[model samples]
Target chain A: MDFSSKLLENAVYEMSQLPGIGKRTALRLVLHLLKQPKEQTERLSNALLNLRSEIKFCENCHNISDVAVCEICANPKRDRSLVCVVEDIRDVMAIENTSQYKGLYHVLGGKISPMEGIGPQDLTIGSLVDKARKGEVKEFIFALSSTMEGDTTNFYIYKQLKGLDINTSTIARGIAVGDELEYADEVTLGRSILNRIPFEGSLKAN
Target chain B: MDFSSKLLENAVYEMSQLPGIGKRTALRLVLHLLKQPKEQTERLSNALLNLRSEIKFCENCHNISDVAVCEICANPKRDRSLVCVVEDIRDVMAIENTSQYKGLYHVLGGKISPMEGIGPQDLTIGSLVDKARKGEVKEFIFALSSTMEGDTTNFYIYKQLKGLDINTSTIARGIAVGDELEYADEVTLGRSILNRIPFEGSLKAN
Candidate 1:
């Protein structure tokens, strides 16, 4: 689209570089900022710049943090021996919100997606393997998604810890808590039946 | 949701302030930015800052521009006596894309909407009336959207130019091009039938 102002065009172009935003949506968003108070734009720009320049990742788990080590990894109450492996900090936040998992996390940064040119080396698997080889972790839970990329990453990590005396397991996949049985996908339903747990054990956990 | 880093949280909060963006989408977008090169983030922030701080509006028509007067308004080929009053720069861009009208534009900034606490004083209506009184414009085409606020704004401007010798007209309300007549809404179809133009005139315009 033809823009009257070069500044407007530049702003819209940069905004459209974002993951999901298109040119038209970027124009709408930039125009909205133009209509708002100037301070709002200043605040947004400062926040984004600060985030990029000043943000830190925890040395232990590679999760986003404000300090050298993240709060989750630094907390004494969290189980250091039981590490949950996941995709990114968003997944860390999701599990943290449940208030159920008390173990530390190892953020993989992303799954192994050859289609996207993201291989195992691009992730934090090497650090995780080092931790396991040093006998720091006792049990490693593969909490990655059930997608093909997720499975590939999990298998790659599992293979890395082949000789280590570490207990490896994956998160259970089944029908969602409030979902209908008939609505469950075929693979999930079949796996749920094959990996059926004890009735009393499920009750006790709940 | 609990964010692992304060910087991440702040960035997401500022991002979510944009229209239609929620907390989850904001997190997704922020994470995407984090995964990208830091220079990309710097470029986006700098572009937004530059646009907000240095952008100019056309003095003649109130359209966003890099100079005192926009290209359309400064061009000698455009009819200065014929002006199309619109809501904002987006409308100006849309009308310019058509290349069907050779008239100048008068951007109102926004429609007067009581629901949003927007008044005529908040718009550039006074300047338009002043132009009409100065005999600079011979006709005005209200090209605002077919909404209550658009109609109210149109009537208010029409009343302000009541005694002036300028002719006032509104854009036609009818079924969109390539849209099936059976699917057209009652009001638009009814208005189209009532204000039907001669077939020869429509054919000639095309």
Candidate 2:
């Protein structure tokens, strides 16, 4: 599309570079910012720049943090021995919101996706293995998604932690809590049946 | 959702302020940016800042531009006596892309909508009237949307130019090009039938 102003065009181009935003959406968003108060734009620019320039990662877990170590990893009450492995900080936030998991997290940054040229070395798996080899973690939970890339990343980490004397497990895959049985997929339904827990144990979970 | 870093949270908050972007999408976009090179974020920030702080609007048509007068208005070949009134630069761009209208455009910036607290006073109706009073424009084509607010805006402008000896017409409402007649809406079908043009005129419109 032809833009009347080079500034508007540049802004739209930059915005469309983001994931899921197309040229039309980028134009709408840029025009929206233009209509809003100038301070809004300034704040947004400053916030993004500050985040990029000053942001830090937790030295231990590689999760985004403001300090050398993140709050979750620094908390003494959180189970240091039980580490949940995730694709990114978003997963860490999701698990934290559940309030069910009290363990620390190891953010992998991303899954192993050969199609996207993201190899196992691109993730923080080496640091996680190093942590396991140091005998700090007693158990590791693979809480990544159920996609092929997620499975590959999990398997890669598992292989790295081989013979490390640490218990390894994956999050349970099954029908959602409120979903009907008939709607569940075949693989998930079969896995749910094969990995059935005690009736009282299921009752205790809620 | 809880963010480990305050800067990250601020960035996501600002990003979510854009129309249609929610917290989850904002987090995803922010994380995507964080994963990219630092220069990418810097470029995006600078582009937005530059657009907001240095952007200019065409003095003649009120379209977004880098100069005092827009390219269409500066062109001597464009018909100055015939003006097409539109809601914004997007409409101007759309009409320009069609290459069917050789007339100049007068962008109203927005339509009159009481529901959104927008009135004629909030738009550029006064400037359009001032231009009309100068006897510079002989005709005006109301190219706004067919919505209630668009009609209201059109009627308001018509009232403002009542005493002037200028012709006013609206864009035709009918089934879209390549659309099946059976699927056309009743109102549009009726309007199309009522406003039918001569066969020679229809043939020439192609």
Candidate 3:
């Protein structure tokens, strides 16, 4: 594709570098920007630059924050002794939206994915171990996905926390809330059966 | 959706304003940027801002350019007397990719769309008429799309150019090359049949 203007070409090139964007879509976006008011474009650029450059992370949980510690960590109402460990900030947001989990969170940043050259060291595993060793937490919930890398990270953290005066647990694995029982995968169905909760326990949420 | 950081929320909001992007996809893009090096984000921001702030257009054809006149309009090898009137720079690039035309071009910016509150005055039709009145062009090729608005814009320009010494013709309306006849839309097939070219003319391109 030919670009008559170098400035347009440069913008399109940078936009297409993003995941899932192609040259055609990038061109469409750039042209849309050109058609918009100059202030709109400036706002977009400013927002991105400000977010990237001036962004701060929670010193304790590593979640993005505007201050040294995130709101969750700073909240006195949250159960600081109970921490939910997850893969990223998206998971934090997802769990937070449910409003069921009243505990603090520890964002792992990502799981241990050897295929992606990501190791436990690349994540917040070491910092989590430090917290675990300090014995400030009563329970650490492994809330990562049930993928292999998630299991590996969970096991590695569990091993690190073993005999360190901390209790370790994982979120239950079962068919989704609205999923049909017949369509549930055999492995999940079997696990759900083996880990079935008391009949009265299932009635608590409602 | 809850955001752990206000900066992240602002960035996602701005990114989601692009056409075809939604909140979920915008969050994904913004999170990906957050994980990358600061330089990558800076490059993207700088490219978009610089393009929007410093972009230029061809003075004659109104095609996007870094100079007063676009390369096509400035090239002496191009046929100045044969002008192709197109809707926008994308059409110019499409025609250029074919490499079959060596003529200059006039970009109309957009078609006549009453539903969208756009009309001839909102476009560059007056300048195009002026160019035709100057008597520098012997033939004007109408290369607009076959949509209703495209036809309206075409007829509007044709009316303005009536009684002028220059000849006016439109690009042919027909089924695309390699299109299956059975699957082709009814309107396109009907136009293709009505505007069927002479057997010799059809045989010319191949």
Candidate 4:
């Protein structure tokens, strides 16, 4: 039967609108939340309500922060000259978890997809160019995904700062370490071959 | 590094507390919420906050509702005398989705799990027994799951209402449709054999 409460129905409808969620799953989540203590649910509610209001985009790197500058942008130890540009804050967290990179980051907000009507102007690319123009950063790392739109966006951003002395680079696209050669896809194998480094004991091939 | 904002950190912590969610996934979900429009995020926050204050448990059937008595309990067409007792509101929704069971429902909050420190006293069992004692319900259907705890709960409830004239029945334990005999687990096969119905063929006897 149809749900009787309009408020509960509304709650489920809103939850269903979230990514990777359906009406049935949303109903389950909403009911689970309803079963919790008022204090607990209220805390979650207040946190979500104040999320955008209390947080603002970092003026320097465009990462999310409670202040004008994000922690990564404000940190002194991080390599300010090497900046990694990504599509969203989640990508920043993904790279941070690796602990391999010690540079700052720039969130582009989204990629360039003409079909979806999302162009370079829709992203934070203009601000990114302005950041690079400040003469502080020496390298611009294109850490966007390997999708076509991601590549187009990267190309567009690279061209914007081509006239400047800043060196541009993209993340590697190849088979991971310890992976079998037979299992590698054509794209990855081709990239690895194109960007090949010297193999052990290989006399510099003429 | 630690989160850029305390509010963001708290939001991540709360989201991580949900089942099957971790710190990384929580960050992704929170970032996704932050990327959405301000109005959509506000709607989600308001829905979560209003859930607790707006909804209340139905005193009669113990189902979640905005009123004192839930819609199912308030309905006159439903078979109130044939109550389908279940462990939680999720079970109520599952049964309601079938549309075959026209009877009303009684949610027990949870099954009898003594090891988890959950006992009959901790549940709404007393209310159920009291309802049974009133001699209004003609049959009590135990629509619990087929887990160890479910069986223990079913047996306990069966013993409690042994002397009562009301007919009591548990859901059947048998072979499911489209199940392969070779693939069926021994326990399921054994239970199915034990609970088997009479053969229809004239030459059925071996």
The top-ranked prediction according to lDDT is: 1
Error of 2 at A137 (Å): 1.1
Q: After superposition, how far is residue A203 of candidate 2 from its true place, in Å?
A: 2.5
Badly placed stretches (over 4 Å) of model 4 are A98-102, A198-206, B177-206
Candidate 3 residue-wise lDDT, A1-206, digit = tens: 88898888899999998999999999999999988899989999999999998899898999999889999999999998999999888899999998899999999899999999998889988999888878788999999999998999999999888779988899999888999999999999999999999999999976
- Candidate 2 local lDDT, B127-205, one digit each (tens): 9999999998999999999999998899999999998999999999988999999999999999999999888888888
Model 1 chain B worst lDDT run, 10 consecutive residues: B197-206
**Model 2 ranges with Cα > 4 A deviation:** none
lDDT of 2: 0.92
- Which docking class does model 1 fall in? high
Q: Name model 1 segments beyond 4 Å from true.
A: none
User: Model 3 lDDT vs. the true structure?
Assistant: 0.92
Clashing pairs in 3: none
- What is every candidate's C-alpha DockQ against the true complex, given to 2 decimals? 0.92, 0.90, 0.89, 0.49
Which of candidates 3 and 4 reaches a greater lDDT? 3
Per-residue alpha-carbon lDDT of candidate 3 for residues B1-206, written as tens digits (9 for 90 to 100): 88978999999999999999999999999999999999999999999999888888788898888788888898999999999999888999999999989999999989999999997899998999899989999999999998899999989999999999999899987788888999999988999899888899878786
Better of 1 and 3 by lDDT: 1
Q: Of the pair 2 and 4, which is ahead by TM-score?
A: 2
In model 1, what lDDT does residue A129 have?
A: 89
Q: Is the docking of candidate 2 incorrect, acceptable, medium or high quality?
A: high
Top candidate (DockQ): 1
lDDT of 4 by residue, B116-193 (tens): 888988677778888899999999999999898888888888888888878988877766777889998899899988
> Local error of candidate 2 at A201, Å?
1.9
